[model samples]
Target chain A: MSAPLHDLTLAEASAAIARRRLSPVEYLDALRARFEALEPRLNTTILPLWEAARAEAQKAARRIARSGPRSPLDGLPVGLKDIIDLAGHPTTCHSRHLLGNVKAADAAVVARLRAAGAVFPAKLATHEFAIGGPAFDLPFPPARNPWNTAHHPGGSSSGSGSAVAAGILPAALGTDTGGSVRHPASHCGIVGMKATYGLVSRRGVFPLAFTLDHVGPLTRDVASNALLLGAMAGHDPQDPGSVVRRAENYRRHLRKGLKGLSIGFVRHFHETDQPATEEVAAALEAAARLMAREGAKVKPVTLPSLTDFAAVNRVILTSEAASIHGRWLREAPEGYSALTRKRLLPGLFVRAEDYVQAQRRRRELVAAVEAAFAGVDLLLTASSMDPACRIDDAEAVEATYSRQARTPFNVTGHPALTLMCGLSKAEGLPLSLQLVGRYFDEATIYRAAAAYERAAPWAALRPAL
Target chain B: MNEDEAAARAPGLGEAWRARAEEVAEAAAQARMMAQGFRAPADETAEPMPAFAVPAPARAVR
Candidate 1:
């Protein structure tokens, strides 16, 4: 049991610690030993809160020893996206801009996690600035994919994906403005969710596009994602956009299958709009078929072209992004990476009429999707145009980032999830399917995704490192 | 010339999609005007951007 304790997941290790089956000190020690060994090869974490982590772990053990009240995350250690602020630790955003800008207070998300008693092992790597990245010109090297260090582990949640998949942390806090969270989760073969636009607060997070940015989780399974999300989901009267949804036990419907469910597929998005590789297509089709066999009313449905989501997302994202960083761009233009500076430079060209028209169109677009969902419980597509690419292919998450996959949901402001569908038999890389739910209907979407996850055999296969 | 100081000084959606908010909102409004079926940009690639632009971010208030 001790031989490979280093590789056991947070979920697996927790039960042992909770029952006094494993010492928190020993578990953490083993984790640190492995973290040290893995760090040189993986290059995933930065500014590990080792001293703070040990102190927290010790406190948790004292509580478990003295009394029995334990927070769900009582003795767990978690990795956080570098963009989220951790008091006293530099919220670097993996860029030189914030190198010495040590946060004076934890971002709401980190504060909440610590309140739940989880250890902050470290701040993990991210694509520089979260919007355009995988850039190495910044303070840290981009995280390598654990499956194949030479391959791409998607960004801007690059480090979160690598850290979690490499078993360096139980779960991680990652932000998804575009497909950042889900893309990495898919490429790294983990579970990731971008909750409804305002379901979680973005306060204290470095802004990319205020409207589209979301703080979410990338975990090894739905259960762990649920635990982390539960602790972090709540109203922050501080964030103007955060909605007032009751905190949900995100894991409630996991055991339920797709009985009496309507799952629709958007095939053209996968096949034509941003054509997926053959293996990706097959993996998606197989998942759909399996759901159908399990009594889901699965059918192909259509929405506007993938091109529309791309255009709208771009205008809105860029326009908002430009506004947020304009001061920074104007003053410290040289501070940002060539990738971000270039990607954002285009926003400088958006006209006022264009911005307003995009918003009005957004209203119409949201209405269109609302109508589309009237006939289905959820919609599906390929998470990415292809499986993991070489991490070195390009620094811009936008390069191969297709208009087909996630942008539409971004336009409609709905909750979307991505799960590993199956391993590409040809390349041994993972393939994933996307599920978008009615705005705020993540529960049903999770039910459908969780049903498929259990019924299919994909979750059992880890990437060969 | 920036949004806060311009004609597009927004009232709703506040600071949220500022420039694009105005552009997309107006694009929908204009498409309505031109009879060019300017449905919102949902999931489609945008038409190459109109050769125009949003005003800059506001200058600091003295």
Candidate 2:
């Protein structure tokens, strides 16, 4: 109890709880206090259930005392993006459209976490239906970066990333279709993993783009991310997209170090395709060097252009999203923010041939990415082409939004993770690097991320609240 | 639905709102055209991803 309970990572807190050094109630109280002090500035939570969470934590404390711990997530406070279903609570998707839409059952992932003894303290904010950008016209204000309140914390999982980075919670679930999870992690200086497509069930989660959408975890560090992912991953027969493989112990390989690992550093991604800011490019180089020092063999590799992957991702996303919202657009267009309406309207114009072509090209793109891994165990690239821009600067936000390497993985359905590499000198904001592994090979991503985290001090850095 | 019908669906909005929606539609149209035009090298016979599969009958529980 020497350190504030809110400051402990999920792993550390779970360990303390198992040993009776800290009770779940005490842990939840600390996080509740942190939430009260920070929520005013961050606007992360849309439906906080702290009292209910505290009651659940008390039960968890008693259960653990009677019999060790259910899992590493036992009694840990994990938040959910508002689009995810939690029985008896409204799954609003941070839009006025869903303000009255209450859920009658838990999302598949939520049921898994609840079974693992995790306590839900709040449902976090997200971009409207996970497609719109941060808009002032939304029912709730967009979550701000904890590193600097003036800057954006990346979305559509804005609240998940901001809350974890600000020490309000150790972990939160975020969905990524076009880099929603990794975008926030990149800007917030936290760990976000979009595991291979369909590795986590999406049955009760609202879809942005059915084929491209993925549920993921955003956490303060790599180890905790692995633990949370382990708890969340499993086959769900009810979910059509769910993979039918047994979930592996993602943390099993965390300590394996980077020795004998061959990493393909996709330099063209941040260098030639979509040029990153100078500081971001330099930090990526430093991260590669750190990995090399850890005994990883780093080599340059190439894939299709950033535009190619991004185009395929967008065509499919917009087309599918358009189809889903066509009725809503025609019936209640006034309910949507201008930004969401603007983004969704484009999909209506896309031809059937265009969507089909994009899907066909997607196979080729996925194969190209797989071929890039021929001589490598993993791929390294930039998560965000630049550090986060100011939240209020719509021009800057629009300009830098598509300038990233993350959409490629979503297009290819690879397990990709982004974690803090360094802090930007000029703005004092976090800069991040991404590691990608073969499909369903998230363990290796965790291995390399943990190694880099141990060597670089960025993982220990916290935003001054 | 066609683009014209899609636009007409949002009737009775403010002039600025309609203008903004028009701009968005125009931009989106251009982007879609560009995406359609950029032909990445792929086999002519490559099938679209997420290819449909027939669901198997559920197995009887023991």
Candidate 3:
């Protein structure tokens, strides 16, 4: 049909490979060609695992030659965020530190993906240790937004966003501590989900904030994110934070329409707490109105002050991050970009009362999200408070890291997904909304996201880059 | 806890309270580790082993 490739979703690829209509080698070669063509413009990757990918694809072809496609993601190449360990590959979280830190063993999630027959082609770029970034002094240049290379791909999972947006990888592994994954996905016009805290294993993941870090998938669309999440969903005893959940096929409920689903709009977060740019605000309105018209109920509601939650998240995230990076901060302080080191240093000075008050406030917000869900099936907000910004604006970068719209959920540990709503006039960046689901009920979130994606096509438009 | 919950409780987590919790928490952690495959290793020097020290650099964050 289309070179057995050409922007086919993971679902389509899996079906074609199962029917023997497409070979994994052909898919990998096509993917590699597209990546090679786009890498210069996108600037989204640090390492491109060509030889390893070829070897993996040949093995997948043989396995399919013996046994028909085993999993929905069989033979698909997934880009992993560089911070996550991949055995034999250096997990250099875009920092000078850990320049040669290759894993002797695969992380629990990597092992699972290997079992699912997914090929990992490269370690995608991330903010320095998933905190300080978009600063060029680090080992790797910050990933450019695929939409406009001059624009910022919102960090800290900057590369994950750019690479997935450029079609270099359909599905990617991204960690969300403070919307590292969701912000970029929303910024880059892709599907990004931040699963509930403890829903996915973070054992081998380099620690940012031990309390807030959660790993999830960034994919081209809903179905592909589902496949990637399904492969990596279960608990591993190795990670103390991983909770035991019954293995549920994440994609099985994809077709469940949003007929009677209920969604609460955290309007105050946009309206007053920190008003979203007019374009972002308008897009959220359109997404909410569209979702409601499609069948799900949408109504305006308020949770904790977005500013209050942001403050709590700032204190706790930085405190824990400071704990994790304190040794590094003291040692290779210059090894860090100025933004991360300075931003993180405040954590060391934060009073224990602030951390505790934040956690105590967290309990309240968790109750608030729980209370909101009682009246609604999901909660919606602008994924990023605003759209992409110019990479050169240092104060804006500091303000951004200083005032992230994402930490509220990280505090409460709810599952949130970012879906592109429309284009924004502000900076001509992609505007999107965050669809947050009840704890452990990502199925409902996926169903709603897929329905919105189905009703309004975002996957059709690629970044002008 | 709310004020009511705090009032109901005997006392709250004060300075000594944190100290006491840290002690008990450390003991509980050791006990759990002993129960698991990992036995608590003997305590050793707790000096900070920083990876690299910035050479006379002033705070440069804006």
Best by DockQ: 2
- How much lDDT does each candidate structure score? 0.74, 0.86, 0.75
How far in Å is the alpha carbon of A449 misplaced in model 2? 0.6
Interface RMSD (Å), every candidate = 17.6, 8.1, 20.1
**How big is the positional error of residue B8 in model 3, measured in Å on the Cα after superposition?**
42
TM-score of 1: 0.86
DockQ of candidates 1 onward, in order?
0.05, 0.19, 0.02
Off by over 4 Å in 3: A3-6, A402-404, A426-428, B1-62
Clashes of each: 43, 0, 4
| lDDT at residue A379 of model 2 (Cα atoms) | 93
Q: What is the lDDT of residue A414 in candidate 2?
A: 87
Task: Please provide, for model 1 over A56-94, each residue's C-alpha lDDT reduced to its tens digit, 9 standing for 90 to 100.
Answer: 899988988888427767878888898898888888888
Question: Which digits, one per residue and each the tens of the lDDT, describe model 3 over residues A203-297?
Answer: 78898888888888998888888778878888787777777777767677778777888788888877776777777888888888889889987
Docking class of 1: incorrect
> Largest TM-score belongs to which candidate?
2
What local lDDT score does residue A172 receive in model 2, on the 0 to 100 scale? Answer: 98
Error of 1 at A68 (Å): 2.4
**Residue A240 in model 1: shift from native, Å?**
0.6
The positional error of residue A156 in candidate 1, measured at the CA in angstroms, is 0.6
Q: In model 2, which regions exceed 4 Å deviation?
A: B1-24, B27-31, B51-62
